[model samples]
Target: MGPSSQSATVTASLDQLETVAAQLFPAWLPGAEGIATTAGGGLAAVRSLAIAHAAGTAQYSPFLVDLAVGALAGAGPNTRRHPPEMRAAGLARVIAAALGRPGCALLLRPPDDLDENEALALVRAAQWLVDHGRLAVWISSGSPAPGDLLPEAGIARPAGTTAAGRPGPKVHSTVRGTVRCGRTTDDHYPGERQPGKSRRAGRHGKPHPASRTETLLEAALATRPWAVGRAWNHTLSPGPLVNPVRVDLLWKRERCVVELDGDDHRSAGKYADDRQRDVLLQLDGYAVLRFTNAQVHDDIENVLALLQQFLATRRRTRKGH
Candidate 1:
């Protein structure tokens, strides 16, 4: 395929993947109101064992518990000594962390050699996660039948893409750094303009205007001598299977991230997503600094001073280590 065709294909596949994800997870829906509760007193969740080729390739089932525990407690011994409930809770927490919300759908791919008893165990485990952890568990296609143990959910795998290989929307690199899917180059730091290159256009071919608050902060940072080596709208991937997040500003050498929050961030969903992003970034050893739009607009000088302090602190800490 030609470059444009390949890009278009990838974009379409990503859209399809998102559609599947949204169908499975209510929280992923646009304007979703937190985690929904069912009339029967259960958390609104997807409990079916989804049978699909993508699930088999993803292989998140076997190490689900381990990944969860490791994420929470750091690298350590096996969690075999932990109770089943504890393990389930840990798994749920990690999955929630990865997806940025509790009760988000989880796709599990059972091992190829899974027996009927093992399949039953998997179903029971998924049930525990749904009941106690409030997670939507989708067991991927192709496991041995567990005898009516789980409600069936169908997921049509996208052609030529495995679950693991599914692409997200393209993130384009700027003169200074890469911009993730949701942001545009007009959001780039004010002072980092590339020589002879026009301002990068947004998806609609017009520049996405930066918020006044962002522009004010960017302008101030541009004049500050200490604000060197910062990249705006940079992407950071926390770990495997997790979507990359774009920070408003990043100083990679100092492992510092700054987020400029607008009114949209006050929503319950965005608040939860921000918290999750912060947790993941912290786990990856980056210090996250969050500033609201009002803060930057009203107290530009103080914001700059505080940011300088934090950046300096991070640099010192890194040097000390």
Candidate 2:
């Protein structure tokens, strides 16, 4: 009932945790990439948060456990109730399962009925994992009171917005485990088979440099100050609707996606898949634009012009909304 001694300890809401999670992955965090919280249960929330954090990549597998449930059920016979120490140990085992894999982070949600002592036990378990340095832990709670062991983290804010206009409370300090965004390069693309300067197989088998088309398109995209991210072979969604297909280019801030069609795209299956992806992206509220590799090389000026107009319109639309 008294004021908690741990009140000054920082706590991150689900929103803050989501921002931190998004930055950890190599995908764009803006636009539809934001995590959506479910209305159902904490398990749903944790899973959704993990998906959003992974940014449509197969990089993360979120493991969820309710400590309170495990404590009540008891891990061993002859005991129906687990003490805080036992509960913490149970949580540790669960956390260990998520470790040893690259790019994997754990999202742990405490049981709803946890008391102060139990919550602290859970916090200690999470802290121990964080200190180990292999796995990252995100604690999700529907309503976290002060003194909960949620350490403060800096949430990425929308650019140029003042504090008063910003939604939710503001934390000026930088987040503890924030990952900064970098320019997307060819090496970062997942599953890119060719490495630096390897020649094999056929006339086209050499690890060639950037094509003229790719160069022109990247140059044009670079001129646009409004586009926060311009990534090739950018994976859109690793979820059920669209997975395994990578976008030719992505503009995160404007939510505009562009795909450069090559000879392969004209085939029956590829064309159909392209159309399906466009439709799915449109339904997800992104503006989809398609251009040919020829268009990129031959008529790049016009292509840039078109993208400029689209980016402007999208920005205005976002501001209006």
- Candidate number of the best lDDT: 1
List candidate 1 stretches off by more than 4 Å: 1-209
Model 2: lowest-lDDT 10 consecutive positions: 1-10
> Global lDDT of each model?
0.43, 0.39
lDDT of 2 by residue, 58-115 (tens): 2323321222112122321211143333322323333222222122233443444555
Global CA lDDT computed for model 2:
0.39
Q: Which has the greatest TM-score?
A: 1
Which sections of candidate 2 miss by over 4 Å? 1-209, 238-244
Could you tell me which 10 consecutive residues in candidate 1 have the lowest summed lDDT?
A: 171-180
TM-score of 2: 0.35
lDDT by residue for model 1 over 1-321, one digit each (tens)?
112232233233223323333333433222224434433422222221211211443324333333322322333333445444444454444333334442333344434465444444544544444444334333433311111111111112212233367432221111111001122233343442233333332222111244455556667888999988877767789655457876767888877777765444445555455655654564455656666555666667866776676666656655766
